[model samples]
Target: MRPTILRNIAASVGLLILIAVGYVCFWPVPVEPVSWQAFVPPGYVGPHAANTRLSNINLIEIGDEFGPEHIAIGKDGRLYAAMTSGDILSMDLDGTDQTIFANTGGRVLGFDFDASGRMIAADAMKGLLAIDPDGKVTVLADRVSADDPISYANSVVVTLNGMVYFTQSSTRFDPRKWGGTLDAGILDIIEQSATGRVLAYDPATGNTEVVARGFSFANGLALGSDQQNLFVNETGRYRIWRVDASARNIDVQASSSQARVLLDNVPGYPDNLLRGFDGRIWVGLFRPRNPAADSLSEWPFLRKILLRLPRSLLPTGKPYGHVFAINEDGDVLDDLQDPSGLYPETTGATETADRLFIHSLHARRIGWVPY
Candidate 1:
């Protein structure tokens, strides 16, 4: 009925599309996408097949204290959990006598007990922390160097000698500003900046130094029983690495002989490492790898374009409970799974004498299954 009007409308729409395309293509995002070689993840099968063993876990409700990402048994023979509310919860084995042990005012994704009965935590906002029995919290190490500080402090391990080793999940995304740990992790993974690193803190010397660098997202750290090596989870690459405990000022990925890949092509984003009853290392696969994300990994331009879009529109992986027991040599002993995702985002599992306590990043309660 109106050809001229229809032409004008069409031109306007075309111009808008052009502008949108240009913005997406040339956006100056913080991430400088790296062209990484990502392989297709293995389907849930064989030793790592799907199961519902962790489906009907007994939950210890934390009320509003949510997101218990890591758990450890304290010297008092009680359960202690690091929660999203920046509080460490202590309770009996049956979830009784619940008490707020201490609040770090920072998110603690992982923690371990030192020989002195102090709980050493790797906090996302405050860096390494030590909480004594009297609820006293001390900031151990917040920065590696003035230029390259620890941005995303993650999982930590304390040796019997009191040396602390921890992971910096991302140097680019600070969890305090970029949202929580998950949000910051998404940005780091999408950017592929390889800024993740590992560091060591000597309590006696009051010094901190970088142990390794050049990981996409170094997520977790676990010291071997021999105390000679450290197992680290590289969440962005779906691999677990073994770094020499004595490694000093080395880049585990770029140059260096002290570190080696212990496990490769893992089924999902390896989240944390926990020492089991018999030197078995328990690892939680936070979520299965996203097919779309992997497919775009080789194409840095596509990743950049993806980053330009709203994070809500991005293809993120759905939650599925999965954990595996492994040895120091990367040998998988067993896999526990809940394919239906009854309990989502199983980050790691702490094995006690009688039960297994599961950690989560989203669930409102801590899950436990009989050992």
Candidate 2:
């Protein structure tokens, strides 16, 4: 009996030794480098002309009124905004007629208008929803699969056939878990896993499919005006990718996919991407470049510590507040910033025929511009 017990113990000890040896030999990912280095790794870009303008703009404080996330403009010149705090709002360009458009009591992240002028929103807690003029809300689709659970539904773009394209920001983390605390370099590393994906929803058929995957941090989706392709903002990798939506072959191996790097490096990390009314692509940028951000996230031990820290205690990127307008190719075209410390930190943006609207999650106000 004693010999039998010793034999079992010996086998367990052997298995433990093998596992330790295997881990040491097989598990070696590159450690986090030294700083927010460049656009690619520890990838930090050198500063260029700040194409950002803090002026041609003014802020609209919605402090206690609403917590706006993304904006959509209607043909009637009314600005529709998704309130992440559980409501939808419509504001006149003048900022006078602010009213509750819908009360879903859920966080609406990205929003767009369809051909029938219905509001299509990507709600974080709820999946995709359609909002009517009377503020009525209907659930279009809800994702329950662990692979695509619509955690941080960041951006939405509607197609002519009533198809909706949007992003589920990150697979490793969600905004509610990492938003306020995503320090410089650590956030970029979380994105390196490239678990982010772009998804499409067809209301006519209630079908949703993963269109594009392997994005560093997929956030925005926009269909080119010519409808030839769609551009997506891979924020973590600091670039935008265009994919073929109308491709014919779909044998998985024969699936048609085309991707181009419109913009590769930037002074600050880019967020949402929307087709501006004035023939340009407007991008929301968060956190300017910093080297320390790299060292803070490079090592696995340090990264685990950083991710566990209370998000509020984490460091925020410099140039804490601003918005940017770039071309579809990712070239900086216009800068919208507030030099003063008035507006909230900007998150998402949308444009109407006459005005450009920007929303911030941590700030008390949204900003607008006369195009």
- The weakest ten consecutive residues by lDDT in model 2 span 247-256
> 284-347, model 1: which lDDT tens digit per residue?
9899988888999889888889878987878778878888899998989878888777787989
In angstroms, the error of model 2 at 285 is 0.6
Off by over 4 Å in 1: none
TM-score of predicted structure 2: 0.77
Largest lDDT belongs to which candidate? 1
**Minimal lDDT window, size 10, model 1:** 248-257
The root-mean-square deviation over C-alpha atoms between each candidate and the true structure, in angstroms, is 1.3, 8.6
Go through the candidates in order and give each one's C-alpha lDDT.
Answer: 0.88, 0.65
Q: Model 2, range 1-371, lDDT digits (tens) per residue?
A: 69999999999999999986666545543333222323333322222343345554577766575556677677567877766567777888777788888877667767888888888887766677888888899987667354646665667888887778877665565545554223322464443566667777878778787777766667777788876677887776566777776632122212344656677666556676777765787777665545444445444455444444565544445554566776665666776655442555566577776667776655556777776
